[model samples]
Target: EAGVVQSPRYKIIEKKQPVAFWCNPISGHNTLYWYLQNLGQGPELLIRYENEEAVDDSQLPKDRFSAERLKGVDSTLKIQPAELGDSAVYLCASSLRTSVAGELFFGEGSRLTVL
Candidate 1:
């Protein structure tokens, strides 16, 4: 099966501008997730999708961030009016199930820098 794919591997934007990132999960996987990882820290879940349903998104900053998993195959994460604190690695991961211990395969991530 193909691995998760992400684009732009890096980005730089001014604070208050809008930025978007993309992800494509592994084939045949039913669970997908978006995570934010700051330097020297572990990845924190931003949103999760079980197929097309967004199962968990409590960690997402709804005021400036939004996401969608249309058709349950691919996903997009958008940050509008970006803030300096939003500069981090936006990683996309996928798994076969929603189990807490399920292993998530991660993409290289889109690294964002907000100036």
Candidate 2:
């Protein structure tokens, strides 16, 4: 079985430009998550989806950032008029089952650089 998949592994753009990242989670995995990691910082949860419902998105910036899960399978994250502070790695992860000791599978990630 395939792990999560993310597109545009790397992206470089000038400030104020628009950028979008995509993710395809593992099949039959009802839980999907999008995380952002800045340099020297741990991944912070941007959003979490249980099926088609966005269960958690407290950290997501609605002003210039948006995300969606289609049919609870694939997902997309977009940032418009990106700022220099927006440079980070967008990670997608999925888990078939969650337990105290279980692990989550992560994609290669989308690394964005705002110049």
Candidate 3:
């Protein structure tokens, strides 16, 4: 099976600029998630979607970040006026909702750098 796919594996921009990353989950996976990972730390959930519904997004920074999973297939995360603190890896993961262990498949991630 094809794994989760992410694009623009690297990005660099000045502070206060806008950036976006895209993701395509594996076929038939019904759950999708976007995670942020800083240096030396594990990934932290930014948002989650069960099909087209955003079941959890409390951890997302609403002021400058937004996400969407249209048609319950592809997803995109955007950050406007990004800050230096936003420099990190944006990971996209997907899984089958019926998995007993809640296994997730992750993309290689898009690394962002704010100048």
Q: Write the candidate numbers in order of decreasing lDDT.
A: 3, 1, 2
Please list the residue runs of candidate 2 whose C-alpha ends up more than 4 Å from where it truly belongs after superposition.
Answer: 97-102
lDDT of 2: 0.91
Error of 3 at 71 (Å): 0.7
Per-model TM-score versus the true fold: 0.96, 0.93, 0.96
lDDT tens per residue, model 2, 48-82: 88888888899999999999997889999999989
Clashes of 3: 0
Give candidates' CA RMSD values in order: 1.1, 1.6, 1.2
lDDT of 3 by residue, 23-92 (tens): 9999999999999999999999999999999999999999999999989999999999899999999999
lDDT of 1 by residue, 2-108 (tens): 78999989999999999999999999989999999999999999999999999999999999999999899999999999999999999999999977668899999
lDDT of 3: 0.95
The 10-residue segment with the lowest total lDDT in model 2: 95-104
Residue 75 alpha-carbon offset, candidate 1, angstroms? 0.0
Can you give the lDDT of residue 28 in candidate 2?
Answer: 88
Clashing pairs in 3: none
- The residue pairs that clash in candidate 2, if any, are none
Q: Candidate 1, after superposition: displacement of residue 23 in Å? A: 0.3
How many residue pairs clash (N, CA or C atoms closer than 3 angstroms) in each of the candidate models, in the order given?
0, 0, 0
